[model samples]
Target: MSHSAIRRVPASVQSLRSRAVWLLLALVLAVAADAPSAASQAQAPATADDLKQVQQMIDKGHTDEALKRLDELAVTQPVVPGVHRLQGQAYYAANRFSDADSAFAAALVQDPHDLESTQMRGLTLFRMGKPAEAIPLLTAAHNWGPQTRVDPSYVLALCYLDTRRYDDARHSFALQYGFPPDSASSYLLAARMLFRRDFVPVAKDFAEKALALDPQLPLVHQLLGEIALAGNHLDEAIAEFEKERARNPLDGAVYDRLGDAYSRAGNYQPALESLQRAVLLEPYNSAPYILLGKVLLRQQVPANAAMYLEHAVGMDPGNYMAHSLLGQAYRSLGRTSDASRETQTAEKLQADTEPKLQNVK
Candidate 1:
């Protein structure tokens, strides 16, 4: 389920890209003096040695020293094609995000096609909380080919997530993870992302594709279970969840989900047992507690329901469902004032979350 780790290309491909850097460096040097300014024309161009020294400093974790050298170079070689790019690299290494952004901007101004500068600038903008600006730049850099180090595709996926472009985020993540076209993992990942955006039908198709490829794939059954639960297909959801539980008995989330499915099917005793197991497995999670309270209430055990509901609300005060269930318990116990208060809080939380849920969908 965790897709954050980016897969690296083969070492030979990386070696080839490394060799191409020299050619890129040469091209940058050839255009160093192309700036149409008297100051740039008066100054000597930065030598390959100068660029190499800064790179070596950065490589050695001497970003401060690299920045100092870059500052000196900027004074005399203000418009040098690759100097700002190197400066940006050093600044980024030092975690000076805004400074890095400015340096990369200068590098892009010098050479619009500078891939390294564009990628660095996009990453810098992302770090500075400007994902909208970062996306296009990252997309452009990713299109330049053979992304070895600092994968632009991974960063672009993150940018898409930040901007709430779920489909783009899923596609970018699949690409960055190096999933093959018909890979089971790719389909599963797509299903998960689509499910988050509430694209149920498409998500179900991808999930089914993953199952067709490998029936025993971890989390695939769980995903299908969740989709069925969302659609109120209680029997199908319970079956899928049971399949997932057989594969991963230790996963508290599966137990919690199974409990929900059983509860929706009006199988309270099994639901209670499953929910209690979920709570035992993940004591810190409020979800099982909330479900346990609701099931207890359904069985007309308000006293026990109130205890679980109180624990759930204590753990996650902002949970509207938990608050609402606690209110029902309070009403059953004839605590009118407490029930009124809980109902008001639940109403407010529901109103607040509805817009966010709508936006996500």
Candidate 2:
């Protein structure tokens, strides 16, 4: 990060909190003597030794053994919050998100204010594809430590990013570090926000930084490709998107970027191929279909274009671009009545939106 970049305390504090959680857990074990057993030998209370052993196993990359210890510890200390907390952390490290969620929930019920447990629970929820549930928990965890820290805020920012709350993500990221985010996440979100505001140079710079940090980052590649496309750097955009596809074969947006780049480069055949792949990857998303239609329309394949546009409208009735392009395709095919209807629909859809086309023609 550049020295001139804006730095804020909240984001820094959040990062510090995340580091402190691990350190505190270690200190908690070292300084705090093990409590006496709360059960018989068959079901003994978990001592600091149990937690330390689990931690050691985890450090050694023996997640299964650590989790097994957590299971035994749980049997003896079912009501002890740390038992569930350890299980949660173990499951999370293993990428067993659903199991981690259940473990975290059990821990939260016993120790509601346990910052580490709460943060882990939030991350587990995020990994479970429940960003909405993760956001508030992460926000609360961020407040557990001093405001000058950064880790908690970083977590909160990521939750916002996952939920597509770009403005909130930007604000959270801005709190700790300025313009270019220190992490790949902060850079990606900042780039998008800057792009949305038409700050092209600044956005491109951050996007490049994001890719430099984590070349496989999805949004970073997408945005960088977009900026390159805007500058008529079609080959550059294709290269960026190709790198993204290599990293994430299932990413629909990468194909969409490829399609856009190919189309602008006047490679209609390749454009169609890429957009078709995008739609195949994300059949429910209407944007790729609309773009596909536009490409076919440019090729003078009105019938094929109309079919895709109709599909796009079916997927997203409110999509003005789809409606407008469908109208154009209908007009090109001499389907006057259909053209008029689609044009009217498009007009209505555009009534409250800008960059408005008065007619499809």
Candidate 3:
């Protein structure tokens, strides 16, 4: 395929199909926060134009500029909770945790009964690695949320995960997953969480349930494959992923996962082929490239590995795994300078995104 050629495939069609399957399984998918919260203060009774302007700024990722306008509005109209709420949302989207918490607090100060702001504040604290502090806030929100058009259960589940309350997390998943079990993304999260908590038996059981509900789910087989691999059943895992590929021939994500399974089985040649296909299908995504590069490097194909590794770094500048793999590729190719640079970049990009140690199957 030509590099510039545009594939006719929709970006997330398989994912969409998976959602349909989830409905059949009685799993509910939570859909909230298409956009972050924003404060609603405007000096002059809040015109539509001001809202449009703020939205435009947000779309452009000009958060600071948007906040400046919101700040001006708040000074003259401190009574509006919407302004403070939106400000908190904007800060959260920018990953400014402290600023988001303060904005939400200010909104709550204006109206103690603002459930939206309270839930958002709890979420901000959770994201900031302070789930212990978030527990009470989220509990309060959950208790009063339905009355105020909020689902406290969503926040509650995350809080439970942070506090290592496995039973609570399981209950939360049972409730929400019942709403949307077949959804690939939802099941993936449940499987990951369950596996992290060392609930191996349940994780496998849930993976099987999710697969039965949605055979073509993008990531469902992958989780099953991982579970099997962890149990030393490499051939079973590979066969499972192969079955998934047969069910959805055009799914690049499935191919990448199958490739991982093949690698674990020590089938380097097939692993290289599957991962290469995945890279071709989703060139803009860094994961397949990284995996393909690893497979090639394992086979001692240094030049081929370097090309894929370079592409991975180009696609995701902040992906530490990509940089680390690229560094290894460079070293294999005897490029000392490139290797050193890549290693440095990987180190600089390393930050904790994974919440905690949970034994994901």
On lDDT, the candidate that comes out on top is 1
Residue 266, model 1: Cα distance from true site in angstroms: 2.0
Show how many residue pairs clash in every candidate, following the order shown.
Answer: 0, 16, 27
Please provide, for model 3 over 1-361, each residue's C-alpha lDDT reduced to its tens digit, 9 standing for 90 to 100.
7655655557599788888898755543222232222332224555567756875786689999988888776676434447787788778778888999999999898889888888888888887889888877877776544424345666677678768775566566656556453454455667777786677777787677667766666667667777787787989888877877776788888788888878877899898889888877876778888888888888888798889888877888889988888898889888999999999888877855445687732
* Off by more than 4 A, model 1: 1-109, 113-140, 143-171, 178-181, 354-361
- Candidate 2 lDDT over residue span 35-68, tens digit each: 3333356576778877888877876778898988
lDDT of 1 by residue, 218-272 (tens): 9999999999999999999999999999999999999999999999999999999
TM-score for all models, in order of appearance:
0.60, 0.49, 0.54
Candidate 1 at residue 211, lDDT? 92
- Sorted by TM-score (best first), the order is 1, 3, 2
lDDT of 1: 0.88
Count backbone overlaps in model 2. 16
Cα error, candidate 1, residue 138 (Å)? 3.6
* Worst ten in a row by lDDT for model 2: 31-40
